[model samples]
Every structure is written in C-alpha cells, then in structure tokens.
Target: MSVLIETTAGNITLDLFVESQPLPCFNFLKLCKLNYYFFTPFHTIDKDFSVHCGNPNYPNPPNIISSSIIEDTQFQDQSLSPYLLAPKSTIKPTLGTFSFVKSIHENQQVFDSRFIITLSDSFDDSLENQVIPFGQIIEGFTVLETINNTPIESIELKRPLRDIRITYIHILHDPFPDPNNFHPYPLEPSEFQLSTMRFPELSKTTKDINSDNNNEYNALTLELVGDLPHYSIKPSPETLFVAKLNPITTSESLEIVFGRFGNVKNVNIILEPKTKKSLCYGFVEYNEQHEAESAYRKLSKGCVIDGRKLHIDFSQSVR
Candidate 1:
C-alpha cells in the first residue's frame, strides 16, 4: 500500500509495509482515506531529529472527515480485535520511514494516529523500541529535507517557526479491506475553515482584564515568534507609545489611567528642552507583557483624556 501526503511544505509519498506491519499500515491507510489528517500542523519539528505530527487536538473538529474517529479513541481500540503491535524487525527502519510513536502503559505498547518521519539515519537506532516504522518514503525526499531544515521553537517546544500542515492525504493504493460497517466520507473537506494563508488561533476567549493574563500573553508570544525568533527573550516590562495626548497630560495621570490594566512600571512624557512642558506624547511601561497588550487592546481603539483623543501602541523604540 502507498499514500501521498500533501503538506504546506511539499508532497511526500510513502510505501506502507502492509505484510510486515499489517495493523499499523491498516490504521494509517484507513485514516488517510477518511481525511483524518486534514489541516493538522506538524506541531513538533527538529532538524537534527525527526518531525512529528498527528496531534489529536491539533486538527480542527470540523475538518475531521469521518465522524467514526471519535475523540480520545486511540488506533488500537479502533481495529477489528483490540490489539497492539510492537516494533517489527521485518522492516528495519531507515531514513524517511514512517513510524508510530509508541506509548507504553502497564508495560504494553499502544498505537495511535501520532507518527513521525525519520530524518537522520541514526534516528531508528536511537528509538528502535520506542517507535514502529511501518512505511518508507518512496518519493519526495527533497520535501522531507525541506521540512527537516525548517526552523523550530525551543527544545522544550518543538513547534515549527512556520506552520507546516498536512493539507490533504492521497491514498494511491491499498491492498487491505475496510473495517466492517465503515463508510468513509465521499469527498475531501473544503479548505474554507482551515485556510493555509493564516495560522488560526485555536480556542481563544475573552476574559476579565483583572484575571491572570499569562495564557493570553503566551498566545501572543507564540504568534510574534511565528516568522522569526528575533526576540532573545519574552518582552518583559513591555512599553506602550501614547500619542495625541493632551498637552498638559501629566505622568501621574497617565499612570493612573493605564495602571487599571496592570502594574505600571513607569511613565515618561516627552518634554520641551527648556520649558519641561509636555510634548503631547509619552511612553507607558507595564511590568508584564500581557498588561501592555491588554491596555493596548482596550485603550487603542478610543481613549480620551483631558478633552483630547489618545492613540496607543507598543512602543517601537527599544527601552
């Protein structure tokens, strides 16, 4: 059996070892035919190691083609007879082979949709027992290399700097029969929901400004690092540029106005050289990045003080 995985990075074709690894191959092929992998990001990528995907929660619920694959249902339980397979010696894992990420519980190996594509030849030797290599990349090694070269997040978070997603899976040949009473979706899902142009933020919700904004700040931090890892560290004590301020707006008033959002580190109003009079602009620094972001989102739209409209944004000038 063979399948073609079309990703944002490129296309990769894999030949499945159906005879040697029937269970893994069967599960993989069935999921592909049903479009179970649609619009799922390659959440973890390491250039030196292998790229991992098949995050159960990564796929948008609407994009899941088959309702048969329910939440929290691992591949082992979906089969005809509930069974789990260990790594097979029949297919010695080599570079560009597909492998299931083994999860051991009670000293028994369990299979799931999550899988990895080998990048380095030494990968198999390192994870021989932990992963099951069920298929080999027959074509598109260039695409595989492209993904391997892509930049990733920190070692703690292996997310790719740019989202490399599986847009579609094309099953070329399948020797295995479908499971009993199984009805796969007839057509591929529309990309309207999961547009490749922009990586959609999942499950964002509005919350009280008084609530802890750590989660909100983390989400913004991830978005900012998408194109480049320019910032050496998370922007702490984030500064905001306040323009169109009332000529007489004092630093104390600015602090009072913005302090409601979060802790006010300091406020500096630009002043004339000799007069020390306000220049109608200033910078407000927040002790936390989320505070500045919250204040910006709330006050940037329309903030009026001392009978003048205030314009707010993150200060471009490095402090």
Candidate 2:
C-alpha cells in the first residue's frame, strides 16, 4: 500500500513494504487514519542526509492529542510496545528510504515514534540494527530536497531555522492486517558509542598579514580528497572548505574571520575520533551561499591568520 503525506514543504508519497514490516505498517496506517501526524514538525533535518518527523511531543498548532493518549484510549487492544522484531536482512539506508528510529535504555531497545526519510546516501553501520527500513519515497523528491537544503539554525540538534510541518497524511491503500497480539522482542545492547565531541576552543587573536609584505607568506595547502561525508543536497555557495589549519586553530578563530563576510551559521573543525583534537581542517557554513563564496575567494587569495597562511575553497561536500 502507498501513503501520501502532505507537509508544509509539499506532498511526499511512500510505498510501504507491508509484507516485510506488517506491524509497523499497520501501526502507521492506524495512526494516519486518526490524523495522528497532523501538524507535526520535521524536528531533525540533516542537510543532504535525512528529514525526521513524527515526534508526538512537538506538534504544530500548539496543543493536540498526544500519541500516548491515543495509545491508551483508541489503541487499548493493540500492542504499543516500542520494540518489535524486524527482519534479519540488513537494509542499506540509501536515498529515499524510510525508517523508524530506535532508542536504547538499560540494554533494551525501544522504538521511537519518529519517522525518518533519507534525503541522500548514508553508510553508517551503527544504523543497521537501530533503524528498521520499511518503505521508500515514490514521489515528491524535490520537496525532500527543499527540506534537506533548509538553513539549519543549530548543528548539534539539527533543527531547521524555519518550521516544516506535516499538515496531513492520506493513506491511498492499506492491505496489512493488524496484529492485535503483537509484542516487542528483546534486543541486545548496541555496541556503538555515541560521540560526545565538541568543537575546539577559539583563538583570542587572529594575526593578519601586513599588506606591504603579503608576498612573504607561503600558502600551506592540504590536498583535497573525496567530498566530506556530510553535506547539503546542493552545494552550498555559503559554505567554505578550509584546509591547512594550524592544529591549534579553534572554531572561534574561524568564526571571527568568516563572520566578517556575513552571519556564520556554524564553524566546525573536523576532529580526530579518539583524541577529539583538531584535524587541521574544517568547514564553515553561512546563512547565504554568496557569503561563503565570498569568504572562500577572498581568503584563497592569500589570507594569513596567526602567522599561518590558510588555504580556502568552496566546499563541495554535503552533510
């Protein structure tokens, strides 16, 4: 069966694998029939990665019936246990795939109500056992792109600066039979450890090169490799790929230099996984692509900071 979701961005249609995910499919269908997804915001949007919604907590239009209430009243006979056993086959969370998020506590896995639709490719192995893919987008990819490209106000939480809400959901066809006696299966604890890394501290002063002796500066260039792992759907003109950074360079120092061009959305210095120290390279995302392009061009022409000549270019990677 197919489902049509009407959102503030646009309509997105999904093709469900009812046979593969009967429990989740029927559960989602039942909720849609009751208008359970109305006014729900896409709270987590990872540009070029995914758009996640279905949080019962942060619904639009202020107050509405909570999922918990619905579970207690209308779904009294239905099993609302969050952890259901999924298929053994590993599903790659590629572009346009749909999956449900799982939360772990005290070595038990429970499903969250959130639904995630991939906007681009992802190969995170940690997601293999945690997310259960049950569907794929059949239409409205451009709308997905629009949502993925939305300017992010917060990087850590992945919240969009503007709101994107699910106005309604229309089930075109539902073929799965409800499993009223469904029970959640127990799961082993996941091995993946969540990262607790934070950006490095910024330098207090950025030393600028004297205009009269600019030629004395030797540019330190790091060879560009394949695009960065995370990026937006389209190449952001307002984002810069910075390289050859001093290992000690702080996100604060980059913000000061780039903020001169325009409002800096985020300054990220890629860090070593184990040490959590600077990788001597980073990215700066701006509110406007033009601002990022401007910073890249101007800085590439040989800008010196803290006695180090920097190499800058337009970032081609998407997060």
In terms of lDDT, the best-performing candidate is 1
* Whole-model lDDT, model 1: 0.65
Clashing pairs in 2: 230-318, 230-319, 231-318, 231-319, 232-318, 232-319, 237-289, 238-289
| 1-319 per-residue lDDT for model 1 (tens digits) | 2665666565566888877787677778887876667656676676756888775345342222222232224432445442234334555566888888777545666666788887777663656888877899865676777778776657777766566767556565677666554555533323442232233343243332224764454445333424213323333348987766778789999999999999999999876544666656668998889999999999988899999888676663333
**Could you give the C-alpha RMSD of every candidate to the true structure, in order shown?**
21.2, 21.5
Per-residue lDDT, model 1, residue 68, is 25
RMSD of 1: 21.2
List residue ranges in candidate 2 displaced over 4 A: 59-86, 105-107, 177-319
Q: Local error of candidate 2 at 208, Å?
A: 43
Candidates' lDDT values, in order? 0.65, 0.61
TM-score winner among the candidates? Answer: 1
Error of 1 at 299 (Å): 63
lDDT of 2 by residue, 1-319 (tens): 2676666566576888776775567667766665656546676777777778776345222222233222334445555354245555456888888887666535765444567888888647776887878788855676787788887768987877666666556565677444454332221111110011111121121135345542232111000111222211345677876766787789999899889989999999876555676655678999987887777777888877777777676664444
TM-score of each: 0.52, 0.49
